[model samples]
Target: MNGEGKVVCVTGASGYIASWIVKLLLLRGYTVNATVRDPNDKKKTDHLLALEGAKERLKLFKANLLEEGSFEHAIDGCDAVFHTASPVTLTVVADPQAELIDPAVKGTINILKTCTKVSFVKRVIVTSSISTVMFPRSPLGPTDLVDETTFSDPSLCEEKKLWYVLSKTLAEDAAWRFANANEIDLIVMNPGLVIGPILQPTLNFSVDVIVNFINGKNFFNRRYHRFVDVRDVALAHIKALETPSANGRYIIEGPIVTTNDVEKVLREFFPDLCNDDKREDIDMITKTYKLSVEKVKSLGIEFTPTETSLRDTVLSLKEKCLI
Candidate 1:
């Protein structure tokens, strides 16, 4: 289960979290097979190649999640697979099951099925969201802190929303079921709103949040779930892969802050871009949801502080000319 000499394949390697995972794996001296939709997309893989030690240890493979057995070649001879590829769209799609549910569930099943074919594949680390575990129950209690055991109720999934949460829940459920049935080692990392700097600013979804905030698009002052740094989430993935004792679900939660907190940070850091006075009309909806990291911490993982995360994210946006 050690990653020093082992080869690990990461799905959606060019993605926000997966890209960081790929970099960390390379830095740890693990050979990384990064799967992208197109290997010819220089814009995607170029940033990954630019990382230290990536030139020699990193390999890019063309793969699609919907295509059955496409991941077989990428996962061949690999000791572990990090399945972080899943559709995450804020707007409600016409067919939630088609766009989110089926892809997430089927893609996870496909990857694990491929893992069953490879004897060397001992561990399968899945990137699940806290949305899968939190936000399902109706009346939020004051002390409701979501933990690893909590799951989003399927009955609560509605039309205008619930698609994303439903997708993650079903996808994770399928992974656990397939792993147990096939006897594959399954480890899931459930991360809250992933923030922090982007390795490739242009290709990351987290960066889009920063861009939207800077552009004053997030005028809604609703309080949401806590945020976790993408770097920390990446580290958690590496730890989950290396730590053989790590199993089940681990909740990666950071400081629980509201949209006002984000605006305050932006106003303090980049006052020129953010109008402090314009936030008066912002409506803040506080939802009682806190993810317990005690389980993940038991695995010897330490998360970065919230201030550090926000500062790093702001600095990264400025560097990318997004603010």
Candidate 2:
């Protein structure tokens, strides 16, 4: 077995993407230590316990991102650690420092601190967002291509009040600084606006982007939807860990679609769910910069098509009664 006898710890294992990572880890025959805010919250964890190998191989630990030494129990005996816990609000937050920044930056530092104390740990993979790379200081031209090399401007993020982006940018920055100073092998997975079927009952921010359109909310104007399936993102994390030469950051993204493109696909497959009146506000000709995925593709990921992802998303939403 690929993961036989190997133990891994995934922080925020009950989240939108981390849940899938836990599921994938279990299926690979790995012993998994999953950390969440409240391990006994059945509403947040029932789906995780029901996974294929959960009963035998999965253990849930309670952890607080802001509290020091909270992650020690979960990460102590693990071979690798996946740090995926971070606030992901896309809307205006009442307290950016407490609600967004502290948890993200402090949580990362705490995890790395714990990782340093443990000798058995070999690698740490952090889940970051393309926002840290794509949100440049200046406006990007339509022909511009974004890759792993670009870092988002912290000052610019603060200027625009992009709290979520700023949080991710700063957190990833903290992770790299800690990893480098401690000589810990670190790999970062930067995924773009993740969307796919939901395993957790509650709707996440990324999934809400699709739900907004179904509910007749015209949230898009000059925006582009850079999407990657949740499953693919999970798989990418494992691939990064398993691959010997996998180093630095990988931008895990797929087809870049615009508001017009989104409306066209939704209308074609989900005509009843889409409101035609709301789509009139969409700007078809506004182009967005493309993301470079060649680095991630080197790991042999053939990304799921955009239409397939959208169809599966709607089907899952309907099944969950969330649409």
Candidate 3:
């Protein structure tokens, strides 16, 4: 909000979280240079085009994660850069490292290299995940609490073959190292499972956790994790960019949630989709995880309540006719 009319570039502008970041920037009157893999792909870009300030303020560029120097054109002359592009998946694939780690780690290096080329760029805000801080659905003590200071041990992720977590952990580490070595201004926002309303017509990764549960597609193990509203994470990105004192990593986790909470919320809004008889199978909040949010709170953010987020997430899906 401090620098109106300033130019900003957001990579993966069509992604689950990046779309919200672009929306917030456009609404605030910033000239947004948004990068997608294909500028011609209507399916990937139509949601962004529908945003309030998209017509006059939004500019789309074709960029790729693996291609070198692809982001240089879009980032040139921008005041700030948001590196939000990364691979995400829950299903186990044939090659984990190649699909998840390679793009995330290499893509981060490429973006930072672009920053060095674009000398006028003031700061880089990276959208890192809480996986960089803690492992989800992994064993933890009852009193254990994860915060920004905690860095996940990649060995465990490797042993368990948790590709998504390993990818995020490696990517966040790579970004911080490159920024420090090159003396580039960098701030990282580590958010937990991002869930909320949809901007893109396609289903976002976080939204799937809820949709699958309501539809009873969850045949595998039920993951217990914390969640944050996507909109709040977007605000944290801008706040970190504008606030001078904001530095290093900030935990943007919301409420600690369980499968039981998911069932309860769905039953209240859509009884047709809910099967109350299966509630006995869901483990109550006997085991929960907590993250310290005092640092992000200090940045003057008022997080939306989890109940409100869950309600909006379902409503958004219904409006989109995706349910």
In model 3, which runs have C-alpha deviations exceeding 4 angstroms?
136-139, 217-220, 223-225, 275-289
**With candidate 1 superimposed using the best TM-score fit, by how many Å does residue 220's alpha carbon deviate from the native?**
5.1
Angstrom error of the Cα, residue 71, model 3: value is 0.3
Which numbered prediction scores highest in TM-score against the true structure?
2
* Residue-level error in angstroms, candidate 1, position 139: 3.6
Q: Which scores higher on lDDT, 1 or 2? A: 2
lDDT of 3 by residue, 1-323 (tens): 55487999999999989999999998788989999999999999999998988998899999998999999999999999999999888687888878999999999999999999878999999998887787644555567776787887788888888789899998998998999999999998898878899899888778987787778654334435466899999999998988888999999887656566767788787776653334333433324555579999999989988878888899999999888
Q: Model 1, 1-323: lDDT tens per residue? A: 24578899999999889988988888888999999999899878888989888888888999888999999889999999999999997675899988998889999999999999888898999999887786555644667766787887766765437788889988998898888988999999998778888877473555566567777766234444366899889999999887878999998888667666777777777686652334443222235444478998887778887767878888987887766
TM per candidate: 0.91, 0.95, 0.92
Superior candidate under TM-score, 1 versus 3: 3
Candidate 3: residue 248 Cα off by (Å) = 0.7
**What CA RMSD would candidate 3 show?**
2.6
After the best TM-score superposition of candidate 1, give how far the Cα of residue 187 lies from its true spot, in angstroms.
0.6
All candidates' lDDT scores? 0.81, 0.88, 0.85
Q: Determine the backbone clash count of candidate 1.
A: 0
